[model samples]
Target: MRRSGFLSLVLASALAVPSLACAADHVTGALKGTNGAVHGIVDVTGAPKGVLLRLQVQGLTPGWHGIHFHEKGSCAPPKFTSAGAHVHAATPVVHGLLNADANDAGDLPNLYVAADGTATVELYSTLVSLKGGNNLPALMDADGASVVIHAKPDDYQTQPIGGSGDRVACAVLH
Candidate 1:
């Protein structure tokens, strides 16, 4: 009886650990930019080393658009500055690459809209997390941030922030 009870307790503890870990591993949110008519959804899987963001978008202008994390997640008018600033986890502010060190935390690859004006993008960045050395603005702790769709592709290198044009739409991540 003692052996059976011990084994059962061990198994139960193992199962419980995984259930908690799985719950902590998942992060999700939505995207709403200036292009009010269309909206997108974002699902993020956070790992110890990196986080994968899978984005599905529709109702865009049908071309190259910048996808990034803005300063604030507020999605306010005239320039959603509330999302705060770019994430640029490793980007030191000199290198001009989305995955580079100087890049903002939100600097992601350019998103392409299909002829139908719909698009989907998947990206992974280690720059998101609370436990890791790298941390993104959008976490459960704060209001997080919004994923913004730019009117133009980010030029990759611009002063202060990327040359990504005005925000067409934004989605606030809770």
Candidate 2:
């Protein structure tokens, strides 16, 4: 009887481990522009190093669109300046992926939109946290954060958004 009880406990523990690692938090947003509509879902999963960001977006212009996590969560539209600047976890950093000095925490690779105007991409970062602790920038901060899409592609080496034109679409990430 004791041996069978031990085996059962071991099996249960093994089974639960995978589920714990697979646990993820999700947030949804509706991207709206003056003449277009888009929707997005961001899935955050904790990893040993940092976190994984899985994004799915639909209804965007076909091409490369610059995407970043803005400071505020408000998608007020008509320019979306309310979403502040790109997120910086610790000290201020220059805005460029190719920059040797620093890169913004919110900086992500350019989102490639297909001819159908839909995209699904995955990215990882160790700068920010969804768990909201450890002095890290949380997705669910006091004012929240936002995912903004620009009209042009991010050059990854230019200053202040890589000349990505126009705030095309924005979605509040709560």
- Tens-place lDDT per residue, model 1, 13-42, is 998997897877676666665534546787
RMSD to the hidden true structure, all candidates? 4.1, 3.8
How do the residues 50-116 of candidate 2 rate in per-residue lDDT, one tens digit apiece?
5577778777789998988888988776899999988887666688787887658778888898999
Error of 2 at 34 (Å): 3.9
Q: All candidates' lDDT scores?
A: 0.66, 0.77
Residue 32 of model 1: what lDDT? Answer: 63
